[model samples]
Target: MYKIVKPLFFSLNPEAAHHTVTGGLQRFTKIWGAKSLLKNLYTVEDKRLEREVFGLKFKNPVGLAAGFDKNAAYIEEMAGLGFGFIEIGTVTPRPQPGNDKPRMFRLVADEALINRMGFNNQGADVAAGRLKRLKNKNGLIIGGNIGKNKVTPNEEAVNDYIYCFNALFDYVDYFVVNVSSPNTPGLRDLQEKAPLTHLLNTLQKLNEQKESPKPILLKIAPDLTDSQLDDIVDIVRDTHIAGVIATNTTISREGLQSEDALVQEAGGVSGKPLTKRSTEVVRYLATKSNGAFPIIGVGGIHSAADAIEKLEAGAALVQVYTGFIYEGPALVSDICKGLLKNK
Candidate 1:
């Protein structure tokens, strides 16, 4: 089904096509029977698929990664699509338009995407309000991926993370500290040891203050060196945050078949090209840390084998973005089915 309409979507600008598809899904879900229909077609329910990580029970280990629904606008629609979980937002304290147009590009030959979205999103407050209004979440876990506004300097970044964390605390099931987006100027700088620890520590303090505080996880970039990953392990242990999402996107365009101009477009690259590197990151973190914490594996998951490869590489869970775009909603069921069969 998706194969037929993919060309049409590919014809439009990438970002425009994204909005159209997501907006259409949101509207379609509003119809009386749409949610049930989608679920019936896509969801794979089995006790064996359940996984408990960071004290939270997931119906399955496959999730929709952050940046898909940045504003928490399509939680229900996404839930109906059979994801075990849906993460929303690299939301900031305030609304921002993000980087200029032509921010998203498709690498058709490589079966990948390059996006410099820069965490563009409606403010955390807006997302929190929308979450508050949700009538039936249907036990679908939601992770809030929070980041600082582009205008906010890195020095004052903790305040931005705190504001977003506090605002989203009650609404989201868990939180992902986002300091890895390449498009945001100096955002990746927060991944440095001193500042990274400070940021996670501050959020941890706030989290501990809450009765039954939610889990906090760090989202890292695949571009990090081994030493940086080692530091990340120590940071997670020191801060006692929940786990890590290994990773966001990559700044590397090492082996893409796309045109030089398209590949040169400044941003993070995701999709098939990311598979091996991302899995390597996950395996390294899991192995180095001795499985000290949970890891949500994402990037380049377009098939069951891709997902299984992530799991085998020590990812407690996995997420999809570019794959979901290219393969359609059936990818979710396909992955879950594969897991069940393998198990």
Candidate 2:
């Protein structure tokens, strides 16, 4: 059980444990039809759990958020883990080492994580190749969360996004434009209206050319102002882009059970501390857009109640990253079951 494995995983360095768990799951799936077995245990087939958003059909509304399977490494395994979908990557155009080690830390007491991982990925091209081969077939929705590299200047950020966008076009079900991460220098600058809208329009132009154009959604940080979110709504309409992801992660450290030194260790804070802000963003988007566009809620979802709150707040679907880390794979089925109950 994940409960038994949680402490052992927590004992190791966060990054190392991530690789170990992913690798182990990948191996497990390779032998004896692992994913199928997991589906038998975790997946609940109920029409109420099905959702259609941004032209994609999700078997369930509960998804594993981006940053969990950055390289598209464990898609099938994660899909088997009962996630209705999985969003992979904040992948850059070119692969980079990302920030230095010890960039990911756990504030266990707060049931949260602070990551300055700086888009550590194997690049868009590499990810696209893998995704092309390991495509999902069991109605498991997959989203590609794309971003510019840390070294890329803000002025030329659009080029980086374009590269990833073009590369991943044939593979992913949806796209999440991620310019909200706090670790990348000057990255947040892209969140401003002009740069953000321009970048999205360019991608939209390129996406329109494809016979079957994919949904393009922007992922904003929880720290943005109401004015910024208003700009986002305006941009979404202007560019004819699909929708919004509501949040990436927050730079704020407010309302923490963790000590100041622990919380101040540097990086974006996610988990319980992010719940309110992220949900607020979702509600604001729902209200501002007047339900014109859909929203995929992400941030501090730790329970079925959190997932449902996002739906009630107007998210067409919902995702969990920090919650999965803190609560385990069972959280996926729990949310799905709760949704079924509510229905």
lDDT of 1 by residue, 1-343 (tens): 8889989999999999999999999888889998889989999999999999999999999999999999999898898989999999989999999899989999999989999988889999999999999998888899999999999999999999999999999999999999999999999999999999999999998898999899999999999999999999999999999999988889998999999999999999999999999999999999999999999999899999999999999999999999999899999999999998898
CA RMSD for every model?
0.8, 1.1
User: What's the lDDT for residue 80 in model 2?
Assistant: 84
Worst 10 residues of 2 by lDDT: 133-142
Task: List where candidate 1 sits over 4 angstroms from the true fold.
Answer: none
- How accurate locally, in lDDT, is each candidate? 0.94, 0.89
Cα displacement (angstroms), candidate 1, residue 247, comes to 1.1
Instruction: Give lDDT tens digits, candidate 2, residues 1-343.
Output: 8889899999998889889988888888888777778889887788877888888888898888899989987888888878888999989999999999889999988999999999999999899988889854588888999999887888888999999998998889999999889999989999888898899999999998999999999989999999988999999999999999978888887788887778888899989888888999999999988999999899899999999998899899999988988888888999988988888
Q: RMSD in Å for candidate 1, one decimal?
A: 0.8
Reference-based lDDT, residue 282, model 2: 97
The candidate 1 region of ten consecutive residues with least summed lDDT is 27-36
